[model samples]
Target: MAHGDITHIDIPVSDMARATAFYSGLFGWNIAEMPGFEGYPMWQAPNNISGGGLAPRDDGFEQPRSYVEVDSIDDTIVAAEAAGGSVARAKAPITETSAWAVIVDPDGNHIGLFEGVVGG
Candidate 1:
């Protein structure tokens, strides 16, 4: 499968409101509350070059991880596994069109693969 650029990042926060306010006030970012994303508040930068959302961690995800963009998350996961990597989070659909997954590289480095859909 073809590869895409890393389009977004996800930040794990214990307090969504606090994190949102901090980033918004500090960097003057436009942070919005997106209920459609399972209460994950999203932060969008002014230039729109870099952005991500804040999700509450409940599954032992103590640290935040960076997400890498790819054409097909399944293919990336397969390649990662073949390269002696492990799947931290299986491929899961974010919406009808987009999908994402977390995997550990050969060196146990956490990496995220994100696939953006046309309408997502």
Candidate 2:
């Protein structure tokens, strides 16, 4: 995917089992915890392409966050800042080569920026 494309979404939930069962049953979504990620249960829509994780809801993270695939996190941060948005979270590495960050738009909406796959 290219920059600005929405690659994933992170849904914050207070009750993991309840939320997982509800979504999976309501939308026919496949939800399960993946290896290496014990607590975060990932969910995929029926289309098989659309998916994200059901993360534990925490302070300052009460809303569902959409992750956009960016060409570069550093560049995205610069552009977001220039465009009146501010970095809510600094770039955090998913692996040695890939990272993710979150920014708050002018209106205070949280948006996630993902830089490629885990090994990319």
Which prediction has the highest TM-score against the true structure?
2
TM-score of each: 0.87, 0.94
Instruction: Give each model's clash number.
Output: 0, 0
lDDT of each: 0.80, 0.91
Cα TM-score of candidate 2: 0.94
| lDDT for each residue of candidate 2 in 5-38, tens digit (9 for 90 to 100) | 8888999999999999899999999999987678
* Root-mean-square deviation of Cα positions for candidate 1 versus the true structure, in angstroms: 2.3
lDDT of 1 at 48: 74
- Which residue window of length 10 is worst by lDDT in model 2? 111-120
